[model samples]
Target chain A: MKQLRHFFDLVARTLFVLSSTPFRMKEFSRQLYFVANGSLPIVLFCVGFAAIVTILEASFHMKLVIQNDSMVPGFAALLILRELGPVVTALLLTSRVGAGFTAEVGLMKTTEQIDALRMLGIDPVQYLVVPRLIATIVGTFLLALLASMTCLLGAMFVTDIHLGYSPAMFLSSMRVFVDFQDLLLAGLKGAVFGAVIPLVSCHFGFLCEEGAEGVGKATTQSVVVSSVSIIVLDFILSYVFSYV
Target chain B: MIEYRGLVKRFGAKTILNGLNLRIEEGEIVFVLGTSGTGKSVLLKNTVGLFRPDAGEIWIQGREVSKLSEHDYLEVRKVCGMVFQHPALFDSMTVYENVAFGLRRFEELSESEIADRVKESLARVHLKGIEDKKPPQISYGMQKRVSLARTVALNPRILLFDEPTTGLDPVTTRAVNHLIFELSRKMKTTSIVVSHDMECALEIADRIVLLDKGSIVTQGTPSEIKKSEIPLVRGFLEEVLA
Candidate 1:
């Protein structure tokens, strides 16, 4: 519970600093490059495979239960747009970007660079946490949109080649079960999960102790907490969006 | 001017700084000498609000600073500069950016003026032409010099150096010691150097405070410290003598 409060405290401080300070375009671009560009290929690779597996498994289950896999494309499209794309991309980012933030900031704390920054009269929150939080939020949202498109294309290709359904047939089925709101909410989930990650990671980073072991522990904790947060938030957003 | 009265710092169950009290006057060169884990670095950190004291008052220039907000601490931070134990240069920035970083924030110098000061500050540390290089490309000693250059560029009234000469060679160590003395005397800079360099402490420090178990073991002028029979002082002096 105390740890949860600390996480909110970090978010509050970073938000306060962000409002007061001028936007750091250079630092934001740098962090965006690290969070978005650096992790893009890996996230795309994993989510494409995940989407394919979803289609195959859904088809198999439909055939087993009711002896008709004709609705596989619609069901797969619904699942991918609603859950697989945003949640998988966010979890991947939690591991890639969130873990990196924890270790990097934890190292800065241990090496006294954070203190050096404070001594220079630069708020570490403004300089370190703000840029990262904004960047991850922006990057994750964009990545979610792109990952959803890629997943749909991959699903279409697999349905055509493996399941003997044409791309046109797949799209017709997909449009029936999924709409633009699902994609928008997926992007919204991406943005919200994005906000949680750097705040949680940097909170652990600031609490890091003195040694490689401390940094290692902080990294593990950040990744676990971020991944878990993404899952819990996925459920919450799903419930909230159900009403939407 | 900095004063720590009844300062205490703890980490979990263990106390690092135990009811420590000390005062540093303006333009004085105070060397805090201590064995490892004696809270030397913690003292330096507390002075700058990096680590707030668990208990007691830290008055800097007659203002109680231990309880200041981080935003409030900025006003005090502007007057002080600290060189950390590590080079502590930002990994992503070049040496020039690192040096000019504080100046751009603290002062409104023009770009050319910042460039000139960055060159001059780096040159003072006998570091030339490495301005464009990142810290990782340079040797550790050179990075330390760059770190010092970054601190001194702002012309801070109080300079807190944590192990300022730890990794430098003999020549650079002497040069740093000379620079400390020169800055204190010429600029009227108040300096608190936390170090294990007894020889340099004896040579250049106006006063030396030996700390043990998070408390002051002894403190005096170098000559007075030289004459003291405290085992810790004698032990430190014996190393220099040998």
Candidate 2:
């Protein structure tokens, strides 16, 4: 119960900090650009690869089970949007952006930038943690949405090239099974993953003990927590959405 | 003025501060001098409630801060500003933003007013044109100045400096010492400085207190400290003189 209270207290403080002027829309937009701009090429590349693999695997399994290429497109779309999209996008960010955030904040703590904030009567958690939390949410939402769309496009290309099914059939079949809830669930999961990933990662970063060794510890912890969280939360969200 | 009575701090098996008592008058610039690991920084941390003492009371401007809640401590901490040994400039912020951080937080100044004060603070530190530069791009001396600028920008009534001149060139050390003297006079801000650098301490400290094993060993003016007969004092002087 005490721990639960602390959790709510932390959430309240976090919200208050983010609502402060530093994390206002202008700053949020600036940090979002920093978080997302450099990774567009790599994100697109990874999503493209995941889409191709989903199509190839779907075609192989569908052939074994039903002996038809007509159902393969929808299967690819469902898999990409429902599962592969959020998970793969999360993995990419955990490696790329999450580790970077850990390293940056960890280095700052070790070097005393965090101490400076405390001395200035600014809560390091508020000034540092909140802006970062906001950035992660925004960055992750956009990344996951883009990944889902590109993965769908990649699947279409795969159908045209390898499976010889036209784009129209792929679209119609995808429309039949996928709904607003599925996309909403995927995006919502991404947002949760986004918020959780950086919060966990920065928590490790802020808790760093000393110098270079501490920074390394934070980076390792960030990756581990974020990756494990993505997997566990992915399962839970999938199960809950199944009921919905 | 700040006062600590029967202050005791311990870290697990280690006893850092044991039954210590000390005081500083309203506008005095006092240097708490000690070797490494002698709890110099720990003493500074305790004054502002950064670390809670195991026992005893910390009085800041007649308020017993040892018993203040974290929320109330924040109010007390507003009266004090600290500049760390190493420049702790926020890397995510530009020099201008770093100096303006505190003003933005607790002040109701307009954007243009905030901008003017930030510029004034930077100019006071002689870091005028470098406002747009990141901390990493600057020299260590300049970074220290920027840290000082940030602290002074907050306009605290008390300034806590933890080893303000630990690693700097002689010129930078002199500049920092002069700035300390100037700010203490100009703002009438009480300064609690901790340093092992005898030269820098002697240059800036109106009163010098020496600490050993988490206890005050000796304290006096620079002239008196120079004439002290205590073995620890003589030994320290000998080592630094060598």
Best candidate, TM-score: 1
Q: What is the lDDT of residue B149 in candidate 1?
A: 90
**Residue ranges of candidate 1 with Cα displaced over 4 Å:** B169-171
Model 1 docking tier (incorrect/acceptable/medium/high): high
Using alpha carbons, what is the TM-score of model 2?
0.89
User: Model 2 over residues A1-244: C-alpha lDDT tens digits?
Assistant: 6534644565777877666645466656666786677666788799899899888988888888889768888878888888877788878888888888788878877777776666556676776667767887878888888889999999999998999888998999999888888899779887888887767767677666687778887799789978998999999999998975
Among incorrect, acceptable, medium and high, the docking class of model 2 is: medium
True contacts kept of 1: 0.89
Highest-lDDT candidate: 1
TM-score for the B chain of model 2: 0.96
Q: Which candidate should be chosen as best, given DockQ against the real structure?
A: 1
lDDT of 2 by residue, B55-155 (tens): 99898998899888766788887898888888988877899888888899778999999999999888877778899999988999999999999888878
Which lDDT value does model 2 have at A169?
85
